[model samples]
Target: MPEPPDPADPHQPIPHSAPWWRHAVIYQVYPRSFADADGDGIGDLPGVTSRLPYLADLGVDAVWLSPFYVSPMADAGYDVADYRDVDPLFGTLADADELIARAHELGIRVLVDLVPNHTSDEHAWFREALAAGPGSRERARYVFRDGSGPDGSEPPNNWKSVFGGLAWTRVQEADGSPGQWYLHLFDDKQPDLDWRNPEVVEEFHDVLRFWLDRGVDGFRVDVAHSLVKAEGLPDWTVRTGMLGDQGEDGTEDAGEPATTDPRTKELGPMWDQEEVHEIYRGWRRVLEEYNPSGDPDQDRILCAEAWLPSQERTMRYVRPDEMHQAFNFQFLEMSWRAEDVREVVDTSLRAADEVGAPTTWVLSNHDVVRHASRLGLPVGSPRPNGIGAGSEQPNPVLGLRRARAATTLMMALPGSAYVYNGEELGLPDHTALPDRLRQDPAFHRTAGVELGRDGCRVPLPWVADEPSYGFGPGPRSWLPQPLLYGPLAADRQEGVSSSTLELYRTLLRLRREHDLGVGGLHWEGGWGPDVLAFRNAREDGRPVTVVANLGEDLLDLPEGLEVLVASGRLEDGRLPQDTTVWLA
Candidate 1:
């Protein structure tokens, strides 16, 4: 049978006079920690708008902002109470509009987070559901089921929360008795919406329009695989630390099977179901509706936060009528070995080609430990969810070396890529962050045993000698910046020729000029198993080969080519261990 058609059937496909995001360098900004404009000690929209020139200078085509919608901040705005408004904690709705206008002026598109899977328990819909009793119209918008056993006391299933504990939470009835239970896949404060409810479907379509009308370019759909649940809400066969559990490397495993063939996993009960595609098809129409009014250069796009069992499984997330791109967690979780990296790249490219979607390579993101420190862990050691250290632990020197090289390799790949906010500075996770400051729902719900993602979300250091590392004009930051963060501050590295900032700037400048975004990737064999070599052609067909040395010995590059970029200094004209070079 022939495979699905390219650009799945949208009522009207986004005009691609140039589908600019296809191979775009899109930066993910964790807003609260990005910059603080007000004296509130947290980053806000005003702060982000002020930093627009900074991102534009870095050469990113778009900025994917993490959740900033009105919320109780139960899960750092992921538990959204109002999808149409901005959280005062981040900024005002006006602030968001101004930020959107300013970003477009700078030629940078903006993609806001769209959390469709769940809503804050404080949402009006959920509140009404609580007041109206079970089986009411409001209650119908959510999953409200009667319990099994006598008196309907037990939870409907054996399902557990992704954060921890039971997924069902029993609410009191109007008569002050324990009533029917509701499902929450994440934190208890986040109630899962019943996608089966037409009200919920129509509500999100309106939410998509609210932002698109405000000039936002696209959406980074949160929990894209989770909006729809299995028809029966059947209990899943639980495994040790499975189901929303992070692997040893601090990457989301999503209870997948331990095999390469994603089909074997059959993770159908709660994730990646066939029903989810219809939801995207609907959303695609919403996105396409505004394409006529949008800048052709900035057609609205949808990128999924789907963590599937394999690259092949992930490929389905981007079929024409669905999302434009989906996060490739498999590559992020792969062991830092030359052969392992090469195999993932080869498979990822082949899979993406089969579906006609741009492959997205991401090394670091908000939920995982910083790739800088993760590379320091032993090859087979589980990447710690949070390093949870009271003192210096991971080998920073070694981690940064690998991180720099890894990012260079990632940028030289065939498709779009993501740069976590602090990755450009080669920031390591703050392993020693005090437990009391921890706020991730995972950490609190698990009583700190799960350390959580707080370590990687620390406020970034922007100035060396400034208070709070210039994260804010306030007295203190939301998450404390480490003392070591001083030297790595953006201010300190701004003009230093050898600093990480300069390296990123130079690389971005070169990447855009070479037009590598629209290029093809070809593997160059003959470099030993210790080296991964691949050549990417520019839109003009000029070739640049990226050679990364993952072994312990130094090696000569393809001779006679001029070196365009290197993650580390060249020693005696040979590439050293844990280094990457781009040759023109």
Candidate 2:
């Protein structure tokens, strides 16, 4: 493999004619755990600014931050109390502005989380809706409905929260009587907005302009598949599980096996409604307004975090007049099997081609178990919510091996890619987080049946020996970091050629140099079912081949293929089990 370029060099700017997002590598920073500049033990915007140079050197085109908006932190920052300001927990608005400026100066674009689906119950709008009583204009801004049962004592529908429990929460009327109930798809503290209401639509449009005016490059729309519900908010009893009880590792676990025939089942009333496209169409217009000259380079992108059932449905959000990209959650949820991986890749590329959009590939995110730990589980094991001391533990060595190989395969694919905050260091979930310290709403709402995402959101380790691994000056982090993280810290891996960090740097650099993200994929025939082999070529016609061995036996490479990089060390010039190789 060629040695990676020095970390000190500046990035070559993208050409103005091409939209950088089409094949960009974007990094996700869950700000609350990225770095804490202050002694607060929680990450903030200033902390992100201090790390901008590191990201630029790592070769990502952009950084997408999880929410840092003013919030009650009920679901971390997803429950937004204020759309226009940074939360005090994440530093002031000035800190955000500085972070944006520093990122742009480093040639890295910035994308912030936009939670338009719901707001913190404490948000001024929500509070006003409560104060205005039932049947008032302010109440119309949210989804409020009368309850069923005697004296309106029962929830209006059979809907359940993704976090668990009833989706409806009744409010206390001013006269001390039971009032109309409001809808909350995730947590009671987060009230779902009524997209059918013009007032709600106008408010979000202004919110988009507010951040765009501050120079944000794009938005990662949270619950982007949501925001619009069925006209009557119908009850869905066809499924055996909770409506939004998406499983761990981005897999769909609706209690029963979903039918392969689309005609046999309908989308739940709260998810993937057709009307959501019109909302994004309007958002696309808002984004275009920022690039009045129609320059593709200046285009503000919107990436959807929608977890739809199929890639074909996912493609709808990225049509020419809608979002630029939606996450390929299907790829993320795949088991570490050659056939599964190849199948999803084929479907994903075809869907993107149909829409004239670049597919977006992601291995892990804040919402799922880190791939380093997830990929190691035994084949066909259930997608676990969280791994505790009593749970069957993943084989650390085996898991990391497959993780490296899986990520190598993902990077070699054709599309934009997202690097979750710490996957570059081969980070694993803090699998044994104690129940008392757990904060994810999924854990509490499910009464521990679902361990939730806190294990994956544990603060990142920077310096191996420093306090909180140098995440902050404080002696601790907001969420506990496992002691095992020391060896995998960034400082320990920086210049080591064989380290995971160095491997990522090499992959990102080669991806750009080869234009692989915009390349076409052609599957190679005559490979075993346990092996995946494909060649990638762009318009320039120079080809790069990627091969992964998922079987127990070693696989031989045909002669004359110049090996560029390998996920694991090759054995006697042969690819070993759970290894991936890039060749030219």
Candidate 3:
């Protein structure tokens, strides 16, 4: 492991002044899609361990593994059945320990996803709760309510599930008598727990302690903002299509009020209750307590996936006493506009400042379209279009240029940056999968309007030509591998100077060697209508300027800044289209 930088140099500035996460680049691994070790066509913990060296070589400080716990495979393991043990499909508990050990051996931290809001209905606890009588402690652990009202109607409220339709599901009473309704925020199989219950809190805390004790480093809290809900379960006035609708409201012709919905505004404070801070605070206390004792320098991190839009709501998960950081989804929604990027960056910084906590940004994840695809290139266009539509040639060089520029922008920002697996390789989005092969629920829910996230969650391509792309020696992977990935394999680009792999290495090394921190951001010069320019200076006075051209034309360089790193070769400080440059 690399030694922590010095802290006592007034003139030199403290090395490693940034928290473990501040300068750290996190790589997200969707476990089921990463690599299949057992060749049962499913990726497992041991498969991940086999790829530790590959991750270490990518220059990430930590690997954020999506949920790998035991599950019925619903929601891709997000519906966890066992928090304390690994699923038989992934591996045994020993495999998890070994994966962690291998990651630490490479100076990489392991952060696992913790889905606390709900659990698989098949979970032992939930099953036991269903088997027990009413008022049972196990039943109290989840949201269970009697349907016997003045007239035996539906659920008490009209709250909609995130997966569409009602959030309530009917399950048999403890004694196998009749059925009763229970609340679930997602699939019917996932029943939301009653956070108001004291025992529920203690049980979740114990779950955290169990993992922390087993050598897990931290957690990426799933649906972190959904922990609390309105106790009254009041009827949400039918005004809009649904509460969590991302695009057009689906309630247009339903004879409901389409112009304004009284329930829309009230949803936030009610679902994302202010009391959530207390819940996170409690979890943070458990994390701090269970962290390794001997290493005072080691810091435990808790990152939350907050879906709320406003800064005030987003900051609730990141207050000093709560989670260490919350994901800023602004960049994920960014279009091909420099102004939009600037606004997102500024808004996130201001929000983080307000809460006195660090900020985090992610370009892509398992849920969204890859940046290359989102950037308006033709579906699967290998290289960025230089100027005209016909110039759709594979420019591996330009691809790396874009990757480097994106990295430069992310690293030079005020807080931590998350890079999805295979992003460093400039992997393009998959767009040709047949409908039968699609795995994302979005397709079914959206009625095929959206292509679903399965395009981004395909198996990682490690080799150019080998079957399964070196994910394993299997005839086929858990998910189909994109044909375009073959030419961009790790083996093909390992030592190449211009490879995307090398650019990532160089950028990560620069971030580490410079000891950059949150205090390093210093913006200067008015941003062009289509260009983003900013300078980041370490406390020690080492300044690096990042300039990105989000427009079609080449951008004129700012006077007096020397080019340090260019996404592509630069002539007289002028950047080519779709280019990025790092200047000293």
Candidate 4:
């Protein structure tokens, strides 16, 4: 192992002395869609182990597995029934151990998703809470309250679940009769835990320690911001859709409007509360205590999934006393405009500086529309009014260009960069999933009024031309693979020149060799109308400038910069259309 680069000057970035994840390029693997090992039409731990070499070859230092814990598959694996064991649908305990060992042998760290916000109603804990009478100790582990107002109507508040309804549900008591209501932030089967309960906090801490003891590298905490809720239980004044209910204020409406609810401005001050920091500090302390060097101050890795739009708010989740990094969602929300990208980068850097923490970048994730689909040129016959129909074939060249440009921009950014599975291959979002085939709870519950996440969660194509495109050896797959992906499998692109996979490999290799993976990024100019430009300087004094053309036209480079990487060819210091360039 190499010594870590100086904390002051990360650009001279050296690999971390212990695990690579401190500055690693993490690749997210949606296990159920990664690779199926048992011919069971679903991916498992053994399948992940078998693909370790493939990930290693892609130059990623770590892989983050989305929730593989035991669940009833209600909210896909987010509704965890047992935090310590693997879902039988995915694999067994032995398989997970084998995966850890194999990933380590290949020099890849493994991070599992830790969803502490809620648990499946079927979980023993939830079941126990149901069995315990109201006001019992066990029942306090979750939010439990009496029925609605004196009029016998509505919930305690107007909070709506992310999956599209009231956040509360009625649970049957152990006596086989109607019981009190419980809180759920998503599906009715997944009830939110009361973090205020010391026992719940201590028990979850134990769960965290269990995986660390098992040699897992770190965690991608799901809904880290939602760990705690406002204690007052005030009725939401804003009413929108079904979340609006009559309140005690005399009138039926008492909460802020619906738009304000998603932002949860009222909850911001309490979002990352002192108690939350204490909880994170405790978890960090545990990780440090278990450090192989036996030192308690050593650094470990913990990434958080914070979907807030405010950069200042997002930074709160990443500090010495909090998480190591929180996902910067600005890039995911950015348009194709270069100005938009530049503003996002600059804002993110400022945010990180304010919190004395590092920043992270992500282009796409399970929740967003695929970049290719979002950027592809639209095509169709002209309508009667001379406007073209909404049907269009993707511009393959432009798609590849956007993919490469995004990759270069992400790699050149400071802190860690996460690459979603299938992103490197320029996988476009699938539009063929019918309403009957859609499995996303959000889409199913909203009846397609809300966009489904199924497009991005489709199965990966491993072997071109194979049944289900090698996602499985059989005809069935958890999610259907597009025919287009059949010609873009890993085996098909392996060793092929000019393939999208090759571009990813080359970019990642450059990132590793130049220590570009860790550094301090600074923007040197105002937002260009169609270009994003910035410089990354390591403590070692190596500075690289990155310029991306978000427009369809050519772009001229600043003087004295030599191109080191480009999404398209550079001609006399000017970028070609739809191109990205790295300069030294």
Each prediction's whole-model lDDT (CA): 0.82, 0.86, 0.71, 0.73
Decreasing lDDT order of the candidates: 2, 1, 4, 3
By TM-score, is 2 or 3 better? 2
Compose the digit string of candidate 1's lDDT tens values, residues 396-467: 898898899988898887678899998888899988888888999988877766788888998888887878
Please identify model 4 stretches exceeding 4 Å from their true place: 1-22, 151-153, 237-274, 292-299, 377-400, 522-528, 556-563, 569-574
For model 3, residues 1-584, the per-residue Cα lDDT tens digits are 98543221111222345567755689999888788898877778898999889888777889999999989876889888989889998999999999998899999999999998899988988888888867888888888877646754567566566555677877766466656678887778888888988988998899888888778788999978777876666655442122223322442232122222444534432257777789999998888886547353477779988766566678878888889888887555544467767777777776677677777878778776566555544322222111121223334444445556666677666567898887877776666666677665545654554345677787887777777888777767867776778877888888987777777777777766655544455555665687887767666666777888877777788788777666666666578766777777
C-alpha TM-scores of all predictions: 0.93, 0.94, 0.87, 0.87
Show where candidate 2 strays beyond 4 Å.
1-17, 238-263
Which candidate should be chosen as best, given TM-score against the real structure? Answer: 2
- Model 2 RMSD in angstroms: 6.0
What RMSD, rounded to one decimal, does every model reach? 4.4, 6.0, 6.6, 6.5
- Ten consecutive residues with minimal summed lDDT in candidate 1? 7-16
How high a TM-score does candidate 2 get?
A: 0.94
The segments of candidate 1 whose C-alpha lies over 4 angstroms from its true place after superposition are 1-18, 239-264, 293-296, 390-392
**Considering every candidate listed, which one attains the maximal lDDT?**
2
- Please write out the lDDT profile of model 2 over residues 358-396, one tens digit for every residue: 889998899888889988889756566677777788999
Candidate 1 — which pairs collide?
A: 7-320, 8-320, 8-321, 248-382, 248-383, 249-383
Candidate 3: which stretches are off by over 4 Å? 1-16, 148-153, 174-178, 237-248, 251-270, 291-296, 377-404, 445-451, 558-562, 569-573
